[model samples]
Structures are given as structure tokens and as C-alpha cells.
Target: MVGLQSTEHAGDNCTPLSDERGSYTTAENGFKEKDATDTHEYDVYGDEDTAEIKYRTMVWWKAAALMLAETVSLGILSIPSAFSSLGMVAGCILVIGLGALATATGYVIGSFKLRYPHVHNMADAGEILAGPIGREVLGAAQVIFIVFLCGSHVLTGLIAFDTITEGASCSVVWAVVTAVVCFICTIPRTLNGISYMSVVSFISILAAIFITMITVGVNGHTGTVTASAHLTFAKGFLAVTDIIFAYAGHVAFFTFIAEMKKPEDFPKTLYTLQICDTTLYLIVGIVVYAFVGDTAVAPALGNTGQLVRKIAYGIALPTIIIAGVVNGHVCAKLVFVRIFRRNGMKSKHMNSHTFTGWATWIAICLAIWALAFVIAEVIPFFNDLLGVISAVFASWFTYGISGIFWLHLTPRSERWTTTKQKAKTIFWSLVVMMGALIMVAGLYASIVSIIDGYKSGGFPGPFSCVSRAL
Candidate 1:
């Protein structure tokens, strides 16, 4: 210990963690630890009030269900279309490959949360990664990504409305209806209340997909099947971005982990998301594309014949609405806690008779959902828009940030001290590079696709009322 200058672990705020007592000075970085029995000190919230019990009350299974709903809803619906675009073989490969990588990154996020328990959102982690600037950058990126995700759900609900009612109303009206309903659902003040609907949301999507697979399989008519071994880079990349979207739940992993009754069960949550999404995605994509072929559409429900599509949409209604609610809840919670509970983990005013607190929460719900509505309507194309959003957000939040968190936490000396350590370092370094590649390459593909949409007269003017199907 001669030159080490040993010190206990310190958080970003240099907030003294209770339970572990005596501390004369703070550790400059978060990478070290101190004994639990040292001395007596208290954080701003104190030992008894670290996190309100209400915030961390969720069981692991419920947490998994919530994550599954948030991630698996609209994403799986697009996979058959990705398969159609990239060729069957390549699409399946991407599903498994990207899914595995996303799961790995998700695990990294959980580990980072365990390392720094004070991190309730990407913004907190961002502060740790750099300083004040990192918090602002990463925090904005996180909320924006979640807003886009919520918007995607609202867009899907509009599409579903069209599918079921055969365009009974203008697209804008349908979007408004979806946003209002989702905002209402988002009024719940806690993740525990939201998790109840998430269970239904997950079941709804699963059932809807099962019906679609069966409908396509039983029809026994290959609807213009075309298989290709080759694809242009743009076509292939678009397909890959859809896969990225399917596994792009990293924007939400921190909140889910933070709310868990046992943080150690996070791997179980990751396993739940990947196992279910990957298996369902491959089966649904390959089976549906094998039957529906090149004409297969994003949000696979469209690939079914008219009546069957209507039925599937009806069943999927819950997921379309509830998944967006879950995303909106997380986004709003990030802002809500920051404003009301800035000094502590949970606000005593959250569910109390506090009128201002309730009013603020309601306003946040309306504002976020309304913004999501605008995003959903402004970018009308489903798969193309998702590719754009995924490329812009997921590549960094889900992949790159997780890699950064891992590299930040692991001790520098441990990596170079042994051969195994060196190999591990190389592996994580490549992981970081892979995230950068996805961010750069995927962004290029998305921009190209959006331009193509404009050139081909496929672009609807922002806030235009024209049917998206046109």
C-alpha cells in the first residue's frame, strides 16, 4: 500500500454511503471500495431513506415482463419485413447474432448499475463516464430515444387502427386517440403500477404473433416468394437496423434494474427478453416470409389477408398502446424524479396529497405523449423511420454506452497483468469498436433510406393527413 494511496469507493457527488461508516476523504474515482464497518456517515437521503421502498418493490418476474413488453412489441412485428429485404438466410443470422450482442450489452448495463447504485438513468452514468457534459449529452440522448420508441408505438396503433377499421377515420385522428389513451395509462406514479399493464402487453403481442404465424403457415400459399443470396448494402443495412431496433431496449435497462427487488436477477431479465424475442422473431420472420415472400410487410400483421390482419390487429391493440405507455412512463419518470426528488432517490410527494406533485406528473405525461404523437405522424414510413431512429439512438445507447461503462469500471492494471486479462481487454475493446461501427454505418444507411423515401414520392409532408399506406 506504499504508493497506492488507498481510499474507499466514491460516487459522483462524493455522497457518503451509509452502512459503511468511517471515511475522512472520498475516493477520487468509483473503482475502489471500502470496508463496511469503518465509521458512521450519512448520504443526503440517509441510511433509512436511501431509496423509497415503493420504488424498489418490483419482483424480478414482473420486471422481466415489463422489459419484455417495452422491447418486444413493435420490433418483432418488423422482422418478417427485414427478412424479406435482406433475404431469408441473412435475416435469420442477424436476428440471432445481433440479439446475442444486445443481450450481452444489456448485461453490461446491469453490471454498471450494480457498480454505481446511485445511477437511476443514463444521465447519471454519463456523469460518471465524463463529468457534467457527459450527463447532459447522455441524458438527452436517453430521453430522446425513449420518446422515439414511444412514438413508434403510437404510429403502430394508428396503423393498426387503419388495418382494423379500413381507414374509418383520418390517420391524425387515430394518432390523437392513441396518444390520449397512452397518456392516461402513463398517469400511474410508479413502475409497479405500470408493470401490471406490461404483463398484458406482453401476452397480447405474443398471442397476436402466434396467430399470424399460424395464419401464414396454414394458408399454404406462398404469396410471391423470392429468395436472394445477395443484397445491396443499403438494403442489407436497413434490414440489420430493424434487427437492432428489435433488441434496442437498453434505453430502459437502468430503470428496470434500479426498480428490481433483487438487482442480481437482471441476467434473468435479459434472458427473458432475448430468448423470447429471438425465438419468436426467427420463427415468425422465416415462416411468414417463406409464405408471404417479397411482398411481406413490416408489422407482420399486414402480411396476413385482410380479415386475418384485422383480427391480429385487434388482439395486438393492448401492446400497441401499453408498450408506448411503458416507454413514456420511463421517460417521464426520469424528468419527474430529477425535478421533484433531485436531492433523494424517491419523492415523498409522489403519491401523497401533494397537489403540485400530481399536477406536474400529469402535465409531464401529456407533454411526452403529445410529442410522441408528433414524432409518429411526422415520420410516416414504418420500417424506414424505425431504421432511422435505431441508427440514431440504439447504436450508442444500447451498444456503445454499455461498452463504455464496462471499460470504465474494470481496473486498468487487471487488464495488463496477465494473458487472460490481456485477452479480456482486447475483447471489450473490440466490443467498443463494434458499437462505433454500428453507429456510423447504420446512420448512413438510415439517411439514405429516408432520402429514398423523399425521392420516390413516398415521403408525406410533416403533419400531412394523407394515409400512410399511400
Candidate 2:
């Protein structure tokens, strides 16, 4: 509130602040002037008037917990399987290195944006760099990404529940139970409330990891764990990119940043979050590999070894189910919010206590859930294609956007004059190119796999075969 002054007269385009307490319009420069007495008590995110308390409460633990929770969703289980496809040594190394590079890039971009308090989200950055088209494209991509992500999560939860209870007569009952529980846990929470759930999820995932490590350690490092002889460097690299999908939730960091009371503190917290995520990923990959080895590591542990694998599978299955549900609900809300607002409904207007809003929310959830069920039943290979598509889009949104940002924001005077800035530009350029290449390759691979599956009743090449085997 200390720095809460109007920038409307500063020549920046802005919208009026809307709230029940007070309304303040902004000028073209995105600044607004308001009387102290008429100033709204709530934060920009529409949370309660506890700025001082909230700012103090966002310690390192909360930030890390949020990051960990978001990172560990359905991606975790899929990561090991992805790695197994590329062979142990190559897969492990690629996952760690790519994750580190991608995460570092996110941190740099996030930090740069945080330095300018005016910038709120990726859309804001896009607008500053490229204009109206940038904002629209980025916003649409983000909203669509969130919707697909949520839908995928819902599908994963439903499928896993069905898989786990395959022979049981009560499988249908369990599926309904899962959907209800996810809705209860996810709906009707403020952004901060979701963060708390994220913290709990983080803890639950870590516990699962601990269980895995302990089981592997107790079992000793002897099994069918040899690397595949057919794995080439190219295949390994692609596998690394595929596995990188596991760490593709950097966009969710924006949601966290929005909730932060002290936006300035976000950079350090974001870095900490990435560090913790990368560390956990490396540790988990190593532990799982050490436990099962290369040859034995399959898509689902049920296909590998029986007793120990089943134990690991049991621990992982529940964690995935919970994480998937949460991810779906969060994603569902994001898409729902965007669709509603685009249609002229405000966030406050979408209260569950209101019949219209509540019905809308329920309708959206049921639609997504039903779609997931249909996809699960009809297309057995949908998950593989979903993972690839998600990765390609995520890479484009992150790498392409960052590269464009650097290109536009860098001053003409310093284009080739300053070594540091020039180097930064070159680095981002390469990142953009690599990301584009990966996107193309992933799409090609996914399409080919689908076609091959249709023609031959089996996966096409090694990666597809490995994906199916896993």
C-alpha cells in the first residue's frame, strides 16, 4: 500500500480497479491516483486485507512447498518411464541437465519480470515486448494450456483409479469417489487456499519418494537394470526432452507470484523452488534406477518385477491419483475463470453460493470428467500423445516467448556492442531454436507413432515401443 499510487497519468494504458470497497480508474500509462480513505483494503488478487500478515507469512517453506506440489503431479510417474525408454545412463544425465537449463531460463525470465513491478504475468511481459498481438497470443495459449492440462489430469486420475481397481466390482464406485474427493479438495478455495493444498501435496509426494528410496535401499542394487544397447545419442537426447516434460509447470509459477504479498521476494523464492525441484528429480531418478536398473524399468512397475515393483507401484499410484486430481481441479478453475471473465462475469460473481456460478462450475467439471472417461476407454494411446503435445506447447510458450522477449527488449544501441547482453541474446536464441526443433520432432514422432499403431498393432520405433513397454 505504501507504493500504491496511480500511474494513469504516466502514459500507460490501464484498466480501472474494481472492488466493492472502492473503484479507481487508470490512465493510458497504467497508473491510478486515489484517495487514501477510498483505497481498497484487499490485495490485487482479491484476497483479504492482510497485506502485512500475508507478506510475512510467505517464507521459504511455503514457496518451496508450492513449487514441489505443482512439479510432482502426473509428471513424476511418467518421468521414470520416459527415462527407461532412453536407457539409464543417457536418460538420467539428460533429465538432470535439461531440467537444470530449463529451470535456470525460467528463473532468469521470472527475475527480470519481477524487477519491474508493473509487469504482472507472462501476458504483461508479452505485451511490453510485442504489443497487442503478443498479449492476445500469450493469453490464449496460457488459457488453452491450463484447460488441456486440467483435462489431462482428470483423465489420468480416472484412468489410474480404473487401472488400480481393474478386476474389482466396485471400480465404478471408486471412480465416482475419486472425482468427488478431487472436487471437494480443489473447488471453492482462494488462490492461497490452493497453495496450502499444494504444500500438503508436496509433503505427500515426498513421502512417496522416501518410500521408494527406502524400498530400493533395502532391496539392494541387483536386478535387470542394464542399459539398452540400441540407444543412440539422438534417441537419448529426445528422451531427455521427453523427460523434461516432467518439469513443465513453470507457468504455474505465475499463479504463485500473483499470490505473493511481496512480489520482490519472488525471485529468490522461485530460484529456491527450482533448486529443490531439480534436486528431488535427480535423487528420485537415481534412486529408482538404482533400485530397478535399466532393463527392468518399465512404463508401469506392474510390468517389471512382481513383489518389490508392486510395492513401489502401490506407493506411486495413490500419489499420482491425488496429484492428478489436484492438478485437474486447479486447471479447471483457471480455464473456467478465463471463459467466464471473457463472457463478462467477474470472479466475485462466480461464487459457489450463487446458483448460476455453481452450476457452471459443476457443468464444467462433469464435462471434463466425462471426456476423460471417454478418452480413457476409447483411446489407449491418448496419454502418450497428450504428454508429447503438452511438452511441445510448453517448450514453445517458455523458450519461444523468452527468446522473443530478449530480441525485442534489447536496445538497438546494445545489440552487438555489449558482450554480456549480446551473449544473453545468443543464448536465448539458441534456446528458442532448440525448443522449436524439439516441438517439431515431438509432433512428428507422436503422429508417426499413432499411424504405426494403427497399421502394425505395435509401436513404431524404439521410443514408441519403450513408451508402450513402460
Candidate 3:
């Protein structure tokens, strides 16, 4: 907290750095405040000696754990299905290739955060690029993206329960139960606290997937394995977007860096995350696809025997709920910070436990969970939802926006000054174009898939009592 500053602004609008937004400098020990902004104190809990709540307590590993938990959860649930559609060769290629790109984009986000220490979230980053409009637009998009993500977790929870229970109870009831639990878990105000829970989340997912892989391998089901397949545009693209969604954790990278004890260590956190997720995705996608082939389903746990599937889903429960809790916490914190920023009490409420602050935080969490529940019930299809999210939001948050950030950070003259600079400029430009293409094509694929789902009665209608268990 010594060198850290609050990401909160003095007013509702995203303030410019010279006025309210200041910068950071690296010290021998770690990040030391160079020109601290009086507009907002970086420390949420004032007076470290007696403060009640603290936000900037995460070390690099803890942040890495949070990113791993957030990124690896439900996203991995669909990769085998992607492999089934795109084949083993293409699946492995996309997993590794997209992961490297995600790592690069995540690095850009860290550099952007270091450049503007006050920029805590996408909204703040947006302000740096385009003032109030960017802040509003990007901020809203971030919230929506996280909420939908949170809802996806809720949806996964419902699937787990139905799979475990063998559809003995209503899926709606399971959704309600999932939402309540996630809302309760999101009550704590600090990422540092959630970081510990993320450890359990990561372990839970590892165990579940390993169990799934072992069980499927033991069964030795024979199905066709193809290097590639012919498919329609919508089908092929949807599979691609599902893989894209697996790397969509970049949306929360800003918040992760903001909470880190040493913001400069973010590259370590980024690499840690990319390494863990990509390796897991490759192993899980390939092994599962090799065994189950065309018969594989999303949330690959469903590929095993009913008994083992139940066990895997039960084990996966923690990740399904906790990962969503992390997303809900980020979304709620955004609103909580905005509320305090508006009243000029951002520090007081954030620093210590106040009745008003606590109430607002709970209310925000409640609202977010409720909305997430509705979204879960409405969308109802797993692969389609992931496709839509990756296409619309992840395309920018994970890829496009970072390209913009790199372009904005580098001076035009400097971009062509050296061979390395020229190569980077060209690479980043291609990254931006790739993001745009994904967004446009992904939306189309998702829309078409959704319509096809309804037409084929592939899943029950929104809010239907039918079980969606894998």
C-alpha cells in the first residue's frame, strides 16, 4: 500500500492524470509512489496500522492464482467439444496459438495499468483513450461481460446439480441455490481474500478434469478422430469462439494488477496464468477428444459413466461457484466504487467498514446475482452462450482493445524507428484486425447456432424445468 494509489476517481467522470490521475515509479524495494494523486488515495483501507479492509495485499502468485481460477473454470468445459468440431490438430493449434496471443495482450494491459495507475478497470482504461465516452462505453461493456460470465457459472452450477442429481429436482431450484451461494461468497470486499478461494477453485477444477480424463480413458470408448472436418460456417466458427472464450480472462486483468502488491510483477502473473491454462487446455482437449471423439460433449465430465460423471460434477462444484463469485465480485466492485466516487466518500467507505458502504456492497452483489440468475435461465445453452460471449466481448477485451492500447502507448514515430518496433507495429495491427474479424464473424455464428438450437429443440426453452445436465 505504500506506493499504491486508489483507482477510484474524485468524480463520476474518468479524470485525466495531470489533474487527478497520477503515476507510479519503481523503487529498489518495489513500486513506490512518485507523484501521488491527492484526488484518490490508492489504499482502500486507510492507515495501514488500524485499517479494517485492505485491497492491495496480493502478491504476484496470488494474482496468478486468481487469474488461473477465473480463466480456467467453465471455459475448459467446452474445449473438447471444440476439438470434436475442429479436430485434434486444429484444437491444439488454436489452444496454444490463442494462448500466446492472450499472453501478449495481457502484457499490454499490465503496461497500460502501470502507465496510468489510477486506471483500475476497463472504464478507467477507456477514459485514458477517449475520455468520458470511452469510460462509459467500456465500463458498461465490462460490467455486462462479467455479469454474463457470472451467469455462465450459474448455468454451469445448474448443469452440475442436474448431472449429479440425475435430474431428480428442478433445474430452476438448482439455479436459485447456485445464485444464493455465489452471492453470499461475493460478500467480501477484497481480491486478496478471494485469492485464497481461487486456490481451492484451481485445485477443484484440476481434480475434476483429471477424474474425467481417467474415467473416460478407462472406459476406452472408440469413436472417430479426425485431423479436421468439414462443417458449415456457423458450426465451425462457433467451435473457434468457444476456444476463444477459454482465454477471455483478460477482461479482469486490470483489476488483478490494481490489487497486486507489486504491480510491476504482473508479467510473471500473466505468464503463470497462460502456462497453466494452456497446458491444461491442451492436455484436457486432446485426451478427451482422443477418447470420446465425435461423441464428446461440452463440460466433458458428461463423457464418462453416470456415476463418475456425478463424482466429477460434484468435485467441480467449487470451481463452478467460486469462479462466478470472482466475476460477480469484480462487477459488484465496479458499481461499489462508482457509487462512492460519486459521493466523494470513495476512501472512507472503501477504507473501513461503514454501514452505508457495507449495505451498498451487499446490495450490489445481490443485484448482480439476481441478474446473473436471469441471464443463466434465459440463454440456457452452454456452447452457444460461450460463443456469444467470446464473439461480442472477449474479441475486444481479450484482443482488440489491447492492440489499441499498444498502438496508443507507442508513439507513431517510435513505431517505425527500429526493426523490432516495425515488427511489433505490424503484429499489433494484425491483432487488432483479427479481433474485429472475430467479433463480426463470431456474432454471426452465435446467432445462427442459437436459432438452430431452437429449431432443432436441442435444449429446453428458456427457464424450462427440463434438465440441462451434460
| Model 2 agreement with the true structure over 1-470: per-residue lDDT tens digits | 22223323222222222332443443222223233345433333333343221312455456656666666655565555555666567666766777767665666565545433334445545555666676667666665565556545544444444444442434334445555566565554345555566666666566656765666667777555556536544444445555666777666655556556665676677677667766776676666775666533324333333454445445555455445444555455555554433211134433324565567777776665555444443455665567566656777654555565555545455556657667776787888797787777776666656666678765233212111111
Report every candidate's CA lDDT.
0.77, 0.54, 0.84
lDDT of 1 by residue, 214-258 (tens): 998898767665655477787778788888888888898888887
Q: Candidate 2: list runs displaced more than 4 Å.
A: 1-15, 18-60, 112-132, 162-166, 170-177, 216-229, 232-238, 298-318, 329-333, 336-378, 456-470
Q: Which pairs of residues clash in candidate 1, taking residues 3 or more apart in a chain or in different chains?
A: 21-39, 22-38, 22-39
* lDDT by residue for model 3 (217-297), tens: 998966889999899998998899988999999999988887888889999999999999999999999999999999998
Q: What local lDDT does model 2 show for residue 354?
A: 51
- Sort by TM-score, top down from the best: 3, 1, 2
Better of 1 and 3 by lDDT: 3
Name the lDDT of candidate 3: 0.84
Error of 1 at 72 (Å): 0.5
**Winning candidate number (TM-score):** 3
**Runs in model 3 with CA error above 4 Å?**
1-50, 342-345, 380-386
Q: Among these predicted structures, which one has the highest lDDT? A: 3
Report lDDT (Cα) of residue 293, candidate 2: 62
lDDT of 3 at 459: 67
Q: What would the TM-scores of all predictions be?
A: 0.88, 0.74, 0.91
